[model samples]
Target chain A: MIEVAGVTKRYGERAAVDGIGFSVSQGEILGFLGPNGAGKTTTMRILTGYVPPTSGTARVAGFDVQEHPIEAKRRIGYLPEHPPLYTDMLVRPFLRFVATIRGVPGKDINARVDRAIERCGLAPVAGRLIGNLSKGFQQRVGLAQAILHEPDVLILDEPTVGLDPSQIRDIRQLIKSFAGAHTVILSTHILAEVTMTCNRVLIINEGRIAADETLEQLAARGGKTRRIALRLARPGDGVEGAIRAIPGVLSVIREGGQDGAFVVETEGTRDAREAIAQAAVTHGWGLLEMRPITLSLEDIFICIIQGEEAA
Target chain B: MRNVLAIAWREVRTYFTSPLAYVVVGVFLMLSGWMFWASLVRFSSLCLQYGNNPYVFNQLNVNDMVVRPMFGSMAVIFLLLIPVVTMRLLAEERRTGTAELLFTCPITSGQVILGKYLGAAFLLAVMLGVTLSYPLLIMATSAKPDVGPTLVGYLGVLLLGLSFIAVGLLISAMTENQIVAAVGAFGALLMLWAIGWVADSATDTVAYRLNQVTFGLWDKLHLGLGGPTVGDLLNKLSVSEHLGDFRKGLLDTEHVVFYLSVVFFSLFMTQRIVESRRWRG
Candidate 1:
């Protein structure tokens, strides 16, 4: 469990994280989505007791990060953007070092580190130097270190920045599997990853939380259906008007372009293909392709960020 | 204490397992060997002219020759070596981002500092131990070596070495650059070593004021919390004063207290700096 109350971090004159507050309940994987310099890392640092917030307070696992730092920190695991790895040390030794510092007994250290190694899929590279490993393996080792202590809260900042597509998917599934045991707050710029792994998404932009809601809620609010491009062999025709009259068609805006196409913006579950088709037959107009446009997560991200800026 | 020891244990192990430790040991043996041989050759040739008799003013050259200056140069070596050893201690952690791991742990900052200090100090002691044989070689050949004073002198060097490592640890925590850490540590130890001369120099203009704050080992030869000599004064002021007594064959309690106090002070300062790091991180 974590509670952040009006947390803000400022460096000299620049505000890294402005007044923002959020909480993560037990067993919930909260996604912290933000563009670069959105103060996501700063917020994560405050939560993990790695850095003090310039103002406000953060509590993790019911302990105040400032007043009870060690206790708060003990409950959480943090994987920084860079992974905080010792390039020289081998994987197993480094994990043992982490476990030792976490107050794990020597006898239990080996077992815990082994379990972490297995959980993070670091078995083959357990004895190799972390610096020599591939980027994906290094990321896994970083993940191994974070969970070595079996912390209740895991804060991973940009966990999959450089991994390949398959590695990213594996990490995503691994993170998804970790949901029930550890309350994870992972900040990433990758929109699809968040959509795939996160139960809830908090879109951060320009040092403020732009939107905080579940995937469905966000999709409903910002996920307008595809704007259908209908081209007809007519100029200044009310075929667009009749098409607008169709059910589930929110609104239609026509544009001057090649072949005189009309941009139809829809707002419901209903696809207007049947209605538009019948209209074309009655109007005796030559119907070109009537493909329904699709908005990807990238489009939604840009829309949300740009929409926030405009507001 | 156990938590601190656990960290210290790991830190000590890292020293031996890492190349930094080997480099430090090799550098010390190579350099101190040169200095020791130079001192020995000077002692042996001078002994030929003096007829192996301890009667050159009966004021033996062990204090004036080998042990005394070795103690002084050890501080210089600490200046050179401590930064190299400790430069990456905390700074590399910060740069590589592993400091977060240390900070987020259940252990206290004091424990971390104490552990790191002991680990590093033990390493220096081991290095000192290797060179101990060289001094023993002198004792082995001497007709009637003043074993008491020679032991005292080595003890003095150990205490002085402790002070340098402690000072070096604090300086290392202040920056990310090992070079800067070395420079800062060197400058600080140099100032401590030269403080006696500076105070003596200032004795002309600020005699009244300098007498109160002047922590010179050479001046206050006797009087301390742990003993009657200036070594005892170390618990209150200048560290070298405490060490100087041990160099002269007096195991004053005050000198021991002085050295321990420095060790604790440096550890305390390091803890505060490491803890305060969270605010900036």
Candidate 2:
């Protein structure tokens, strides 16, 4: 339950967050994809009420961040890029302090702290000084603090930035599990995390949002195009002639090598696989493999940002 | 008010948890003890000579009085220790990134300031406590020595320290550097000390009329305390001046109000500075 309409943050001459707007419904996970210095953190800062937007407004769970900062901030849990930790205190004490300040009930404070500790896998280092903990543990402590009070919405920036692959997987799993119960808006430059964790993606580049939609929709959007790769055993001389006879095959270009493989380049909505397979079998060619080859999220992201810049 | 206490409590815990708290307390006590002993030795000579020591013999001698001479050293302690305490209050947090966590909490900016002030003030009071035995020890050796003045003198010094810490907290909020915060606070305190001097030197009657409003404290000690020496007014307006009155067993309601007012203004300013960083960041 978030509504951000025409929010722009300007610092002197540069517009850090150019007028950009998007909304996240309850139980929805939205991934913010952007390169470094792309205003992703700036936009998240505005949403959390940590800073005021230069123009327009953002509401968290129906409360305006500017007009009612405390109320809005209460309903939204935020983890800033750096984690904003008090390094002098221990991990458990720090989280308890956070819970106290967030106005969690004193009677339930211990239970909440234990729950957050378990959820973030911080039980082992509970009593260790925050400064003494490893970066990965510190990052977990940061996440633990954000979700300690169980806010209605969770806003995390670069949630998996410094973690190892296993830690990253663990955090992503935790984040994924949060979907459909907590509305989360996480920003990252990593494209794969978006495809895996967030159902919807919002691509921001050069201080503006260039693309926003579901993963499937993003892949399906833009010009109508498709590319496929096929592996087949050495075909007879009639292989090209038989493949050309398949309907909706724009160009059946014979691509490379003595292994006799073919990459059929097609246009528009059409599946030429059955015809290609039948043609190969009819000619006594071994049909080994056939798979749909589409653009990965990274390719899509690079293409989107590059396309906008080129335009 | 309660939230302010919670923050202050946390600040206090931080003092002990990090080396910051122990280091500040240690340095403060050592310097306070040094100043007290130095004042005691000078007091012995003053009592033995009974104002007969030649003034020109010692270039440092402003008077044979212990309080006045000690003021010069008190300035150094204020400049040295206060910056250390106030520097990390906000600057370290802003550097470490906890300022955002603090801001996002349910508490307001005002609570943060109050909490920081109280935490620093509590440590300072403990620092002041260690030096308490020195005066009590002073009383043990001499029956005629003024104990009332000694208690009030300590009271005045403590208030002066409170004022410095409060102002230092505000200056600490202005920048993220501990050294800059220390220097800014020292400069501010030094100016307040010099206001009466500048006011006193004005040749023009109009200038005198204008300086009165700015240097009212100068007038209060000279007129209100009704002392018998040239340094009497200077002593009252400068921290050391009122300190001497307390050492001499005098406590004025006006001096008490002056210390409290200074404390209130600095705390309010500290709150405002902390609040501005969010928009400016």
Candidate 3:
């Protein structure tokens, strides 16, 4: 429901978003991962029609953002990094106002506003002034406004930034509930937010997209070159050499600072556990434990970022 | 149009919900009330002096002596109050980051400008409405309040306030700081109001040309031109200058068009400035 093609936003001599392209299909929740100053917010601003991209085009629900701003914007529900709320307004009135301006039918305005308030868990604070609400509740108010009109696409920037763990979990649950009915592009620097809520991940770094893959695909890629940690009860001579001798075993080295422990780097998806076990028996090295180290998303992110820096 | 009204209604509600509306309105009414009382006292003193003198009494028109001076004083008060009313229209939105919500909405820049301008204008209307009690008091106590001129004078006040709020709203859109917006609007309005002072020092032809285009309401009192001339052109250009004619109960369409045109032009420029932010961002 959202398409960004070769978008580059330049401010004078600096490019905030350089040659970035991505798309989110209907009902797909795509997590936008990037560190600070990674052009994630800039890309969201362009998608929402708040800023015009210097080059290239952004479309929401098949409408060009710059060329047909109103039409495109009508289909988008945007929650900026700051939430863009009027602090002086009460929660209910504010949502009603948002609904009105977003072209919600007058007859259904109350229903829509009430639904949003309930969905964002803002019913208790509905009568309170927004400025007086806690940051987490205020963030809910922001999300409530974005979803008030039930737009086809949602572009949220750091929606869960300042929340406590429970609030973060609540917001993540709320975002995850939008799957398959609303196409959402959630931008955040938090690694777990993506893992918990996103179907696919697009990692942007230094004004460019560093990596884009499904969660499973990225995990599979990380598993392509595997590492294993092993421990032995007996100290046996030539154990490392014997383990290294196994086919598909790339290297076997003793782990420093840990006695009777070794790390094995293997090529491909081969299960070297059997070979290592056999080697331990043949060398009379008492086997203690052996497990393949699974790479987390954080590791994958760091690896991609570090790989980019190295390149 | 519905979107414009929605935005306008929300802004109006905000004005009242915050301390800004009450504070500005309260201060404005106090100043207007004081000015009214002062003008009434000065008129009563004049009445006493001319009570027995037929010639002077005939010259001492109550509308001329009391109502006209009150309107003039009220205009000066508006010069101060209007900037305060409009300072937060766009500037506060930008400051608090709500402008992003507005821009990302389906509404156009023109609609936002219209909504903000109308919202501030409505506040000015309420302020002017409260001052009506002063004129009603005169109507009740005096034998004749010269209802025609008094009504037109009220109309003149509203137009002048409308024009001033438009300029103030435009100034508000230029910056995000409320104090800066308020002070900047005051400076712009002062420049517009004080421009007529310079017209007096120039030679007759130059003075007429300068006052015609400069911002001063006093020039219309001196208007004797029967046809379009340099002086006529300059008189048309001054916002306050047209109020002088309305004070005499003239109700000229020319003055009405001038006020409306100034309002339209200012709002147009404000919309342009707002639309440019998206491009410049």
- Best by lDDT, which number? 3
After superposition, the stretches of candidate 3 with alpha carbons farther than 4 Å from their true spots are A232-240, A257-260, A284-286, A308-311, B204-237
Candidate 1 residue A20 Cα shift, in angstroms, is: 1.7
lDDT of 2 by residue, A126-243 (tens): 9999988988899999999999989989999999998899989999998988888799999999988998899999999889999988988886763365666777786667776777
Best by TM-score: 3
Model 2, runs deviating above 4 Å: A230-247, A250-263, A274-291, A308-311, B42-76, B144-147, B195-200, B205-249
**Per-residue alpha-carbon lDDT of model 1 for A1-311, expressed as tens digits?**
89999999987788888998888899998889878888888888888777788899998889999999778888888888988787877888888888888767778898999999998899999999888999999999989888888889999999999999999988998899899999999999988888889899888887788888888777665344656888887635676678888888877777775567888877656777888888887787778768876666566677788864210
**lDDT against the true structure, each candidate:** 0.77, 0.79, 0.87
Supply DockQ values for each candidate.
0.54, 0.55, 0.70
In candidate 1, residue B14 scores what lDDT? 75
Ranking by lDDT: 3, 2, 1
| Best of the candidates, DockQ | 3
Query: Mind giving the per-residue lDDT tens digits that candidate 2 earns over B48-167?
Result: 665455573333332335543443455457657876777778887787778888887767888788888899988888877776676567556652345555567667778888888888
DockQ class, candidate 1? medium
TM-score per candidate, chains pooled: 0.87, 0.83, 0.92
